[model samples]
Target chain A: MQMSPGSRKTLLRQVPTVVWVLLGMILFFARFAPAFFTLKNAVNLLTQGSILMILCMGVIVVKITGGIELSVGAVMTLAGMVMAWALAYAKLPIPVALLLSLIVGGLCGLLNGFFVTKMDIPSFIATLGTQGIAAGISLGMNNGNVIWGLPASIGYLGNGTFLHLPVPMWLSVLAFLCSFTLLNFTPFGVYVYALGGNEQALVLTGKPAWWYKTLVYVYAGLMAGLAAIVITGRNMCAQPTVGLGMEFEAFSAVVLGGSFAAGRGTAIGTVIGVLFILILRNGLNVMGIPTYIQLAIIGPVLIGAIVLSVLVEGGAQK
Target chain B: MTLKSFLLRFSRLLALVLLSMVVAVLNPNFLKISNLINIVRQASPQIIISAGMTIVLLTGGIDLSIGSVVTLASIIAGYVLTQTKLHWSIAIVSALGSGLLCGLVSGILVAKVKLPSAIATYGMLWVGRGLAFAIMGAFPYFGFPNAFRYIGRGILLGIPVPIWIMVAVALVVYLFLKYTTLGKSIYAVGANPYAAKASGLRVDRILIYTYMLSGLLAALGGIILTARLNAVDQDIGAPFLLPAIASPVMGGTSMTGGRGGIGGTIIGTLIMTVLVNAMNLLRISSLWQQFAIGLVVVLAVWLDMWIKKKTA
Candidate 1:
């Protein structure tokens, strides 16, 4: 018997839910085998997942605008280093340093947006160029040294607990809520999805899509800046390599959440995706798998996610 | 060629000459034959890989996985030489074969599976790098035979053997693109894939062939790199990724596809090699090298766009 189109669409929509169930079962089994199912461990996983979730949110916004930003990780590093330099070297107030880092991150995003919109460069190439520049700047800032001894107030964002939960977890939740509101409630958010859906149609309506496109990148950069803050606070140090490989992780999470490369992704789905990755990594760590081997596993998982999304979405469209 | 095309093709060369003169003034050693040969030798791997990258870019695709493929290919060769009793020549062929397999996978994903080139190749990049790291446990592979080492370091006709290999590969690529039916098809496909398909061109086959060729050249580069260092490591090919891409882009190859050639890539490679060499001689910190590269990439693309706009 053939399935009806309506049924098929409903079934495709359930794919993420089914995957989440399977992931839960895996965690359940893993708890038994490796004794990794503790409440504390679960909370730890959420805490670690928070930074990635923030970064993934940014990526989702950019992806929704039909643009890719490969430089977010590098921007995160530079922002963190700048924050570290401000606090440690300049002896600035914590709030001032935080603002400085955010500004730097926003400016980097602005540069990326300018290249893509004004210079007519591809998003990937433009961001890759920025990636190198940001990374180089991070390296040059402290000559590749790690800055430690951050004040307790600064560490509060990453390490402090509120009502028995990590600050980063709360921050991530707040960020996700804000993003959901921005994406679903505002006209600018509507424009973002429209920009991805059919840019020319929006242009035909006499709207300036370029500014909206640029705004998405700026939002992404801001998220990265926030991530850098949490990362530095948690470690109590800022290093040139702190955010290395994070862009891939963010990309993987966003894509795994069923966001199409061409645009159309939800912030909630990204949260699920980030949790799945964190649980998988935590489980692997518990099982004593080497980091490199874990990396190997993530590669196939990312490809599988892409293949699944393509097939399911293609079926839905048909 | 018309004057416009000539200018477009030689602009990089002109930049190279101008930069060289400035560097020579700053450091007299820059003009020495030894330093010049060293620059060419150092740029051999870039020239080789960029030759392949030019084809990929020409087809409006990318192969970010080439860097990881280089590492994996070299590791495979290293494994064959150290773990097994295979002959050196066999090990070398197997390395190239591994790269070919990778390229085939990327091609199938892109051409048949209909995935975007960036996502598909980025996935391949992770897989390749992961395999390289997993296989060697993140350790460097050493202990190559002297004969294998000769391929990377030995001099031939007063020049490095790798440089000779690079030239030979570039010549073959030049001939292939200029004279072959398949070569012309690549340009057609990149120029407009839908139109090319409607016109009876085998677009998928062209894409697969181009990616395979890119993979093959990247593998060749890995082998030369392995031989030069007399060891294989995960990080060896990491630095080459940007340069591989930047060389072609700087050489006037359009990232959007169908507007550049190997001739431009060679000049682009020379320009990059000279820039880095000059930076070293000037005692600039190594940390700033990436900054320089990033700036060059952005400026080069901006200049290309400006020129296109003006001519139009």
Candidate 2:
């Protein structure tokens, strides 16, 4: 029997939930198939997923504006390097170093925003250019050397526990709460969705859509900076290669979470998406699969997720 | 040509000349013919790839998978040569065939599957790179026949054979773009897909062809790169991808589509090659080279936008 359009729409909407269920199955199997399933492993998964989740949050914001930020990974690297320089070489306090890194990231984002809005460049090309610049700066900062000997206090954010969970995991939760509220409760958030939905219409309505669009990029940059801080804390060192290929990870998470290509996403969906990927990787590691095999899986899975989402969303519309 | 068109055509040329003068001043050896030939030789792979990329950009699409395609193509050729008794010519054909296959897949994804070009191609990038790694098992392939090396590193009457191949490819593409009905249709499609469709142009067909051409060219570049390096590795074309994209954009090809040509791309390639050569001559750290390239890309786009504004 042919399904009605209404039924098809409802069925398609369950696709993401089905994906989550599949992930749950994997988690359950991972528990039984190997000795890798324990409270400690779960905490490790959460902690590792936290920084990536934060990065995915920023990516979601920009993607919601119908733009992509390819430079976030590089910006994260740059921010880490800058923070490391401030803390290790300049002898700055941890708080000041962290603040400076965030500012640097924000400025990088602002430049990306300016290029997209004022300069009328495509987001992909602009960010691609900036990615090179940020990577270069990261390498040039310490001549590609890893900066070690960060103050012990800096480790608190990355290694500390709060309420029996990692501090970074808690921070990710806070970040998600803030993002959800900002997206749902604020006028600016509405503008962001509208901006992605029909930018020309907003422009015709006499609204400065460019400002909001640019702000989205700025926010993404700031989040990258925060992610850098967390990563540096966790590793206790800052290296030029930190955050390599992270943009792809975040992009995959955002897409897998049902964020439309033309912009539309949710913090909760992204959390599930990030957790799904983290669990998959963690499981692969436990199973002793080579890293290249993991890459092979990720590439197809990302493409499949995007294709499925497009198909389902299109069906819903019809 | 009108003054406006003249400026559009020669802006990159002017930049190239200006850059050449600065490099010459920095080091007198830069003006020597041998050094100049060396620059063109180094730029051959980029030039070949950028020709196809220009066409893709002109159609308002992108092919981010070219880098991975190059690696894969090289690996395929390398595997055939090393593992099979196939002649080098057969290996070359297979390498080119692999690239064409990749391009065809990407074309179908973008045109038939109705996926965004960027998203589809980006996905292909990962798949292709993964396949390259899988095939080679993280090892580099060497020991190719000397005849195979001739395509990339042979000298023909005191000039590199790759430079000759690059010039020929550029000539063919220039002619195709200038004198063919399909070429004009590509421009029409890039200018306005809806209008092109309404006017009886096969928009999807043209898009597919463009991406296929991009893939083919990327494969050709892969072959050349493998020959030049005399080895095949997983990272064969990783560095060329950015420069391939950047060259066409720097050449004043509108990323939004329908406004560029092969001539501008040549100048862009020259400028980039010369710039890198100058950096090496100056003993500048390679870390800063990426920064310089990024700065140049942004500035070039910014300048292009300014010119468009002034003309408007």
Candidate 3:
């Protein structure tokens, strides 16, 4: 697995500017805030960030197909609601409830795919519609109340640690690996890139571009489903609004991970992007910055990072 | 307009009327004059916001920041009117100014920096919301001066002031889009940006201007909403975002841009407003409203696309 020195140097040169930003941020936070550079904080940050990390993995797949998946957050919430309902009301076993959550998430994704492929709706609007539907169902499931009283075993999925790592972290890493393998090691990955880069060309190649595109959405939904289980297990309850606004954070993460445009992201790059946001958020929190100010800062920082990446990329081309 | 085009155009209005008939039949009170005025008044700010959204959509760009722009603008105005000794006009100017500034930045990101419109504006959404939250903090602003509240609450000649403002906005937007070179340029840019640039149109400027207009209108809508509620909170503008996009698309304004107008947006707004009214009258759970609105948005766009495909 060892890389030759020359190949390693070229690989280093190809890294995005955001990596530098991330490194600089780490140094800045470590120096300015003594509390931020600890092992405990690092674990805490990743644990807190695991759900978003998982969601971004799914979103990146859809992004590769030149589609923005806005429904993931709501889909996650809906899935959690379904899971909670199964556990508390339907008296289902923990495994059955978890499976039901994944099923719900996949169904929502299928709905989004149907809208985009069959109806020719734009991804954002189609997903926005799905967002409403999912959020609505989540709200309506228990008359907008939070579901509680899960069996004790359910907590292990969210709170337990495995091999000296948090359970959610394990799940997130699993998601990351799955996404990476699916995109890089399979023929489907080629079609996904083609779907984003030149959909018509892919269609003309005698491939079923429509089905692949639909599968991309369904894949995203399944990830949301996975994230939902973690989030629900973490809280031991499912509020209808639990996944509110996570989609934007995941989208931002994917974009910041060097996918400036569609058809151009990698799992390693996505990991970097997730770390960048995690550090920004964790650093700001460690500094005792107000939540509102942190929000104000994140937006400009996101835009600035992308702009910097674009400039660097352009400069490299020249 | 030719007979076919005329029928195609009026058919939306016909559908609105038929929907009203159905609602009226269910509730019987839906046909009352007072109830009708209430619906128009309730729909006023939405129509204004959607009118702005129609302009952006006409340019083949979407502004995800308008909802936040609405919140930011109203919070600015509320702060000005509630905390300062400034005239209400000054407050209005500042609100509009804040929106314009936001739109300008979003436009620069999309046009000059070459970012996607959705991403650029979506970033602005958080920036705007964060600023609003930072300014307002935990306290909601309430109890505006009568002079300012008059815009939202006043009834002139037996019609609510918002309805009047809505009409004014729609009329001005309609005339501007139909008659002005810049308006035509917006359409040209949306239809085909490369062609527009080759034809010597200032595509970037038109985009910036369209976004600016949208921001301004969103501010105005926010102002009316604030005045009506006499309160400004952090999430006040969030609910309006989806409907603003939906109304225009539902009104026969194409999502692809360059093919819709303010007239259709008004009808679209009416249809949407009536649907909500029907839901309320029917006692459908308030919890299901978001689902219904979301479904309507999807169905509207699907129908629009279907009709276009068949026509093509």
**Model 2, residue B282: what's the lDDT?**
90
TM-score of chain B of 1: 0.96
Clashing pairs in 3: none
> In candidate 2, how many Å is residue B208 off?
2.0
Q: By TM-score, is 2 or 3 better?
A: 3
| Per-residue lDDT of candidate 1, residues B16-44 (tens digit) | 78889999999999999999999999999
B100-198: candidate 2 lDDT, tens digit per residue: 888998898888878778778887888888788777785688989899999998999889999999999999999999899999888888999999999
Expressed as tens digits, the lDDT of each residue in A1-318 for candidate 2 is: 145556767677555653755466476657655756767878888898888988888888888887878899999999999998899999998889999989988999999999999998888878888898999889987888999989998898889988888999988987788778878899988888888888998899898899888889999899999999999999999989888779878887886676756656777778877876887778777777787776676666667666666664562231
Which candidate gets the maximum DockQ versus the true structure?
A: 1
Alpha-carbon DockQ of candidate 3: 0.54
Give the docking tier of candidate 2: medium
The CA lDDT at A290 in model 2 is 86
Interface RMSD of 3: 2.5
TM-score of chain B of 3: 0.96
Give each model a TM-score. 0.94, 0.94, 0.95
Candidate 1 Cα misplacement greater than 4 A, ranges: A1-13, A17-32, A315-318, B1-6
Steric clash count of candidate 3: 0
On a 0 to 100 scale, what is the lDDT of residue B254 in model 3? 74
